[model samples]
Target: MSRTPHTKTPETAPAGGKAPDPARRSDRSRRAILDAALALVGEVGYNKLTIEAIAARAGVGKQTIYRWWPSKAAVLLDASLALAGDAPTADGRTGLPDTGDLAADLKQVLRATVDEFNDPAYDAPLRALTAAGATDPELAARFTERLLAPQLALYEDRLRSARAVGQLAEGADLRLMTEMLLGPLTYRWLLRTAPLSHAFADALVDAVVATA
Candidate 1:
């Protein structure tokens, strides 16, 4: 099916009749911008981050950054969303896996999440987003709506499924359960205290599952 990209992709004509394949310049620039933003946040943190600095680091025009995003918070939010887009679940969606054993599925998810929490790529941008969220309520709302809520919904779905199949107790508060699963990892990440490893993830899973 013939379709159009939302943004202009580079289309070059090599003195020929047919247009060359789309170059995906918009996508590249967007990625570069995001990379630059995340790196800057890591180096100097969110408050000191600036559009010009991001453009300079990305090797794109300042106007390019402005054309795509309004503020640093918006850029961070989009970057997080973009990363989430690439991370598909076992079902090819952004969510946890279901292996009949809720504990196992949750452990697998948390293990991977622990790795990401330690990885600089995710750690920096996530920390920046949280910092931005603290200072800017509007950005926080958008971040929650765009990233947090959807992810929470996935856990909710999984918990609901568990309940239906008698894996979860009757009238268990899925939302609180979701928080219990996520809270520790996020807290450890923010604290920068210990290594976020599979071991820690396993412990969290065991702790939460013990209560269940």
Candidate 2:
């Protein structure tokens, strides 16, 4: 499928007569490329996605895509991150919800994640990415650094807050705590060992928090 991107006018010179920002000049095309990559992955599956197809769908030349991303995996990685958006937030803040009741907040977020994992639109594309990452060490490293680390940091931040309030042990390893809370859910989602549900999410939160 082809999409006609919205045309953007050139940026005006600054008050000091500086040239228009080079990065800003390409923002429109960048957005179009990312959006196209995301949509095509959802429709065609990541294995079938290609730079040529993405360039065509985004209305840009193939060389333009290669100029920014080395491979289709990199393009898909950026597209997935774009779709995930900024850190998980309820009030537009980066940290996870801290409602004093750490268990409840964790459950809420985990349940939402369960919902996302169960979504048809997200399920296939995510599975495709996971399969690719399993075999490609380079892509896997990029995925962990660019996508997984930020999410883990958010959870660690919340865990730190809980520890400060005496809810979590002062000596608790925040990084381990975050991983413990999320690891099972991720495993289940990726392996499809069982159905992902709010009940399972709540149980996982209770189990991890009890240990912490």
Candidate 3:
């Protein structure tokens, strides 16, 4: 499958000022490389994927990729971030959809995430990546650091907001609560334990809110 180049840009500086910094332009090429990596991994499992393949697919030279990333796993980590469309802000925070209604906000984001997780375009590649990470310590660490931590932080932020507004009980363990919300869905999906449906999500929200 042909890959779509990632063109998502960071928030631009003031209009008509000096164009983006040279480093920022380099970042764009890095994003493109990542996009190619994810697409290739998704299309052809991780073991078969190579630095050369990613470079060719990304429209960059092998050295360009090697200059930024030491290995295919590193490229995949960046690709996962690019595919998620999340780049951390200057303050190290990645934004999550905040509609002020905690349940609504969480449910909306989770539903969209479920859709992405289930998409053929995303599922195969991620599954392959996960499998590779299971055996590769370095890749696993990068996966946790780059792909998983940011998402968990977003959930933690939302839970904190809910606590502030009294939607969640005082002294709630945001980490545990976040896990409670995610564990079941991931269990079902990763293990094929059962179907993941809207009903399951609604029930999850209800159960979690009641505990909060």
Candidate 4:
């Protein structure tokens, strides 16, 4: 079957978990590799995805992948980062979208997030990543460090701004507040407890602001 423009073959890291510098790779090839990795992992799960399969799908040499990443987990990590709009800075800070109105800024950010979670492109790969993280401690830690924590820090930055402007309750635990803002939505997504929708986003915003 011919691959769609969106479909690309996955890539795996080298035997020892070494990877190449992404900056040196062609942007098109890198995107192809990441796309392939995500699609393969989503379709076959991580264990069944091989470097050969990914290389074939990506139209790249296995050595190219081996030169860059040390393991399949590393490729998935990089792919997930690409899918999520790049990793936050090394300081664990990716500043939130700022529009002066805290509520609007947050609502806008969350809405975009809801859209990402709802996207099929994002959903399958994310699910695969979550599944792998469940059984692999090292992969899980890297996943948290590379993907989850930085995203959470974006929320932290927004909340801190709200606190600074007195939009939040004085002395509010920003960490807990950030959890309150995100935990329920994640709960719904992970557990299928309910539908995630714009209505849910509005409700979440209301609940969060009411407590602020």
Least lDDT summed over 10 consecutive residues: which range in candidate 1? 8-17
Candidate with the greatest TM-score versus the true structure: 1
Best by lDDT: 2
Off by over 4 Å in 2: 1-28, 42-47, 86-93
Cα-based TM-score, every candidate = 0.83, 0.79, 0.78, 0.82
The better-scoring model by TM-score among 2 and 4 is 4
Q: What is the C-alpha lDDT of each candidate?
A: 0.80, 0.81, 0.76, 0.77
lDDT of 2 at 171: 84
Candidate 4, superposed: residue stretches over 4 Å from native: 1-25, 86-94
Q: Tens digit of lDDT per residue, candidate 4, span 153-195?
A: 8788888888898888887787777788789887887777888
Residue lDDT tens for model 3, 82-112: 6676432212344666678887777776676
lDDT of 4: 0.77
> How do the candidates rank by lDDT, highest first?
2, 1, 4, 3
TM-score of 2: 0.79
lDDT of 1 by residue, 1-212 (tens): 33765544343312333653344556678899988887888788878889999999999999988887888888877877777766533236645788899989988888878777777777777787788788889878998998899988998999898899998788888998889988988887898677678888888888776666
* Model 1 stretches with alpha carbons more than 4 Å out: 1-23, 87-91
TM-score of 3: 0.78
